[model samples]
Target: ASRRDAAPTGDFHLPGWLDVPSMAVSRSTSRLRGPGPANVSTSGWTSTMHSLRVGILLGCLAFLCGTAGAGTPLLLAGSTVLYQRVLTQPGAAARATPGTAGGRLITALSRLYVYEREDLAGQAWLRVGTDAAGRNLLGWVPARDTLAWNQQLTLALTNPAGRERLILFRDWDALRSVLDAASPPAAGRALVQGIAAGGTDRRAVALEPETYVNLYERFYLLPILEIKDYSTAAGNPVRAVKVASVTLPEARGRTAPGSALADQGSAAEQLQSFKAAIVFVVDSSLSMGPYIDETRVAITHFYERIRTAGLLDKVAFGLVAFRAESANEATNEQLEYVAQVFAAPTQVLNGEDFLTRIAGLREAPVATDYFDEDPYAGVLAALEQPDWKDRFDARHIVLITDAGALDGTVNAPAGTVPVNNRAVPAVDSSTGLNAAAVQREAQRAGVALAVMHLQTPAARQAGNLARATAQYKDLARNAMTQQEAYFPIADGTRDRLRAALDTYAGDVIAQIERSTRGAATPFGPAARAPAEAPADAADDADQRARIQAIVASLGHAMQLAYLGERRQTAAPEVFEAWISDTDLADPGLRTVEVRVLMTRDQLSDLRDLVAQVIDTAQTDLDGANSTAAFYDRLASIAATFERDPEATGRRRAPELAQRDLLLDYLAGLPYKSDVLDLKKSDWTSWGLQRQADFVDRLRKKVLLYSRYYADTFGWVDIAQTDNPRNREAVYPIPLKDLP
Candidate 1:
């Protein structure tokens, strides 16, 4: 007889939390047991009563399953279920029986629950369905045809428009064989070519080259089912992950591949009229006159070049000037303004107007209290004050500064000066935005902030060059491009600065011209160094190389975004097979970026958790008589914080304790979190200053979370008609953005 879909054999139900619609696979594997007490006698009246109850419940479940639609869950017998979750292999077929005489094809990478297991000879078969709830059933299939996925980890392919096509291998040995070849790149190329040519040897490859997908274009799940970590013969580490592509319900009805917006035009034709804007955010301090003049000359030369190329109207330029800020109103009056926008991005299309606006720009008359200037003010102005979105598709802000930014930290070593040295009290930027916060806003605005740091001798002597370099690099970092648009001048000469600016501007123009002509400019592969070379030096050669690479990447990213938005270019709609997370030829280049699917409630909880930690630490540290006592208090507080929510008053549970979803997910993930797994010993090991720095970093992260919550456009609504804060609506937050 065919097995019936029914509920568990007794009056049993999952906990309230587990009553959620989604079935999350448990990370741990434990032995299954039947319902009722283990020691109950089978022949007793109590046992007979239990058996009768089980039978009645099973009968009711059978009636319900028969009456329900296809999407309803089939609650299987809990005792017989082997695994909580499984994913179908590519081209996997399910049959009515254990043998594959006749079968129906199932969706590859579909999440399923194992209902029953059968073993015959040496092979095993599993009865699987859509979820533990028994929503959709697919009959018995060979064990090898499915993969057990405990963790819900997924990988989304990075944009492949400007890079080589990503390859998927049948197995690890096939991938390793290519890596061990005489010339790995050449061998990989040959393999891809052979696969394209078509023959029996094509079986070595997992999927066709054109099927790789990005999460942004199509919101799908490519779950990482299994992973193998090993070192190559050359001692380089490599990670080989087994991935199964799952197209979510939302991806249905999208325009098929190769036919996106065919009626409008090709992606390139649509991009021919794409607009770009570049703004020069110059520091107007006393020492920046020469640099300011150089900036003007560079823009003048650039405008003439673009005009000659018949692209003057397509590209626009603007300028913003920033000076020092002070707490005293009189001192602020002397400084004139914290930051002033001299020209809107779209205001200056002609060379004459742009030159006229820039020609009168001058340095501040009086020197401020500290060497570090309020560059954040200028960046915010450049980002906020302009109609960048309405006028331009590709927006950029080139910050030309000799000094570091005024950091908000109380005693930060790099961008901060002593409180006593100031003639007037130093004030934060007018917008009250720090570097990281400014970068987030820039990201929200879809504008890239590039920094041209002039490493002058005075800056180096003031011990600000190194600090400023680090700060500027972070400020200019782009998450999409995964590169920093930071160009540092070793000599800090006007000629060098002008040349760098020219090269940077010229590269962008060239990219636009090439992209407009239907040609894609591929960024050069990263340059590898010998084992003895310094790891990450800010050398002039390296900086120039980075500038070129970042410019190219940014240009490519901008073009891709435009095309995706215009053409409605969705990701490929197909179940995928195994694909490598990293590039097969270049293991160092990751083809996939992992992101955490977070919700509004989770972010709010995170903020509250950090705030609570900060408050407890501050209060405990101040009242404790000794460091040991402080640690003791912190340990006790940590215990209280993670304590069971029910143990605490139901109305007043700790915010962190209430964050079950995020906490459980993070615990399962392999990455270490300082906040989640913080220990008393960890706190005790830190010196007083380091401890304070830790608190300060957490405080900043809290502030950033507020900005993220307010960014209404960044979050997506998976359920379009549902409330904005509904659980279905989520933001795929970059892992790096996590506190």
Candidate 2:
């Protein structure tokens, strides 16, 4: 280090990587010592004094060398702004110029947008800045000290409590080799253990399992820079993706100078303080009197248990009653209310208060025109009426109904959007929400819906049971749990309904107990591994197990949320490392899930584009006798709709299939579209039925887009601009929901 700092005095040689020429060093040294003493006494003492002065100068140079890349500036190789971005590694410094010193110190895993690239003696250096536009220059950083991140695609890690700790390998081959082993799981365990024990192959592991936490409910994102697809030795497909772990800005600014949870209280105290809000949305027509009476009994008993456990403040209940609406105003009046909010969760201070508030709740005197009722309206009310985010971490709505939800029926006026199938105005419900819309709204509010469907004799006779089951399952589906939390009571017996409610309530209470005892982990003392039921297990056992699993999932989510808010748990800052999407312990379970970051404008554009395709297909396909005529009509329509009709001709695929017709946000996504890639030839090859199927798929996509656009809860203003129009405000949409 001392010799390198001397600036080539008396045949000093620099490292080849530094690429400093001898003449350049000489000129630099000469410039530094301008107009010094010309003559001096040639004595031993003078020589020693000169040597001491040189030593001081070299020491000062070494101090200056602390600035990374303090040498000749490398020539710029290119100036095009790179679409790809990068994250920094530890000790990475952005110098003022390529191979020159003194610039900003970037944090590990901090995102940087590159403006230019330069190579000096086989070392690549990137000129980066603060933003994608390259407006604010941050300076140059060596390519070796950064990780390439192109798509901005990120994965949210599932809870690691039940699963083995994710092993981040140094490269793809290391991960693949483990998966290819005769016993992949055993090999994976051995590799992890070897790394943990500091064996010879320790360098193969970039991060230990314990360094990462379950990012179930936090802003932390693990950006996937690269992805590899491969099959295991057993022919099971697996994906190994390279990810750059980051602790985002949102994770900062919590309690300072200590563990955030420690600042509040002890770990046990913080975990025990988990709160839950459960709202019962009931179908209360004339025939529901007995069920309503039983519901009251179940709640009263559950309240007693909660009070006994001293968790009165931790749990609260609200009620909503929904009935059917008809085209006739008189029918609606007779029904009294489509969805009446008896009590909001906020209004219930205690168990006594909850009961008192809903004392007047009862079944309506009149019945509806059909077996299907406005259950979605009741759910919408539950979601909209309460401040779920501020009040509770575990928010749930238990929908108790005997009949199916009102999706579509013959009795109605025309032109209303059909939910399941066939449009009708009256069935649109008072809230103007469909099943899909209701589910999106619930997600926005972070509320889970659990349906208790009583498949009554009447429902079976009317053939509404099947439709009700499908609709209720869709409504109650929990993404984290990967299953619907819908419970079907085949006999619709009051006693059975009461028993289901008891079990649901008891499971929730058990979760709260486990959480409070610092047993939120999968193998914690309070958490027992579920006993596998026999193949011929009773419906009751199945229902009980399902309820337990759903409640446990909900509890896990709540704990994660609590930890995120209270503890500020963050992902490990690994610059670049390879990790498998599936868990090592159980290959069937996913360790990470994909999400697409979309802006409101982009979603709206996608919705509009899909709607246009639907309109065009509906208008043109009906009149056209052949596929050729349909193609001609589609081309004409595209010319009429697009701003530059001539540009439409240049499109790779005609009309609806044109990529240019979609938003820029949709264009770069790592997904293939059924409609966007269609050519005239492809459409001609597809028979009439297949073509019609394509149109139908677009319509479904349009419906999904509408639901995604309507989701108000998920949009996050990352830029903090306060302006809604700013494109920086994005929502991390689940990839499955993408059209």
Candidate 3:
């Protein structure tokens, strides 16, 4: 293995396809292949099987337990302690008295169930620990209470013992094994690679469907093992518990981690197995102000784009800024910032937190302007950071700078910046390594580097400009030169800088996707949410629920229409617009989905139409427009949609045709159904529900006109030729000015 022989220098070839045999088999050794073992339940809603997923999540594929008593059911709730229950003795009253000294809530989830096992009632309840009184309690609330986890992952009752309320939870730690050469690829990414060969859907969509829910038409495979209890009526025990050969969930969705019930893999298991981290090394020296400033916009804009697309969780970002004490002057500690201080990589949650951290950060304003900077050290430090070292797959560093490094071997000109006389650490032969050494470290770390040459005019005016160019070019070719990682922005305008960064970001995503192809992370990743305030949690739940409902209703036919261009391809975008408007809580991104997919002219026309529709609907409100008025408006539009598309001919035939179907749904709305019509009552509340519904529906109709052009990573306006428009792919929604 240690022999260093001459390797082939030419590019490698793949014969049209690289086939990887599927690792899962229906054998008794590692897998569970079967119809469920049954005859032990007592309920009306009998259990059934959903084909989602399950397995070894920590060290390897978590195997299905051979025993029937697999796990304990988790407390499904909005807040764990919100509801309280009492562990009444066998002879106690039917209802325990409130505020009783012996009535402490059942708080402890650990060792929760023990008594009756063979026959047990299957129902969801909150299991809390003992209060100061030392008594255990249990509680139940309505199903809407558990909506947060419910929307993303499927939940079910456990087997015989779990039915007896003696199920297991938090088993991931006990089961975690160290990953070696033999572990199977993670289910998230592995499953994605198997579908459409991993190119049709995004890596996030393919891997963790919980976070990247909308990108793919077909959701993640929600593997349901078996249903415990199934009942049609209220107050019935669960109809049935879904069981599987392996510990899978239902067909609707997959779990992020271990909740109460049996083992639903951990978030780290569901997501990280196929994750990537990106580090940006900028020359934050005296002259780097404008570069870093503009790059901030690019980073923030890029983050918002992917976040809306539901793919932000797939990558993490780190920062590194390098500048040695101006030329030979060593007093300025500002310029002596180390590598790790440049910025360690972090997972991209919802916002550009890392970018924000660097926003107010200015370059070290030095006494004398330096034309050269030490990039090699910064690169080496980034590679060594825990973020880079810990990633199982896809590590990348994006180097952005206007200047170059000093080469000791070259007969360098006088007064060049980063003026190290062979004394700088690593660059000096006597005690330190040089740029070549840094380059080797990057390669050794398996990090692909994306270099952007931010050509500044001041740097061009330097006497050693020629030498700087030569050195910059060499540094640019540091690691993975063949991957198109270098982008030299010659014009150097703010627009050019942004474009370069966009192109740079795109390259990083593409390379990661390519490098991780046919491979799976030993474990996958699940997103982590910071602890939120009570009000904030409630608000977020409402907003997310609204979006999810629309996504859920975006039937295969609707998604197909939006994607295939065979019909109204913007139907789903239209649906989301309705969600943003009617949500009880503030939905952060309003019209991003619809706006980015529309052409510039289409966007303008849609805005005008939406404005006009709002104005027209405003006059009919006693309080607000009734559902009847909403239906009438829709009927009118459907009748003469082509005659007055947008009430103007700004739309093309294809777009107008798509708009018609949207009008049809609204026109056909049931005028007086209790659920559909809140006009007769509930006018005392905010904005009046019925009128709000009407307005939101009209907003959807306007957005549906935007003809969504399909692409590899979902849909976009195919006409956007420039990188700015393409990367600004998802813009924030405009606030409506309601009277």
Per-model TM-score, in order, reads 0.68, 0.69, 0.32
What are the per-model C-alpha RMSD values against the true structure? 15.0, 18.7, 28.1
- The residue-by-residue lDDT of candidate 3 on 651-708, one tens digit each, is 3322333444333322322111222233323433324333444454444333222211
Per-model C-alpha lDDT, please? Answer: 0.56, 0.56, 0.33
Off by over 4 Å in 1: 1-154, 161-163, 168-218, 248-271, 356-361, 385-387, 410-446, 516-546, 565-567, 574-576, 620-668, 674-683, 720-727
Judged by whole-model lDDT over C-alpha atoms, candidate 1 comes out at 0.56
lDDT computed for candidate 2: 0.56
Model 2 earns a TM-score of 0.69
User: Which is better, 2 or 3, measured by lDDT?
Assistant: 2
Residue 304 miss distance in model 2 (angstroms): 2.4
> Judged by lDDT against the true structure, how good is candidate 3?
0.33
Which residue pairs come into collision in candidate 2? 272-516
Give one clash count per candidate, in the order shown.
6, 1, 70
Worst 10 residues of 3 by lDDT: 569-578
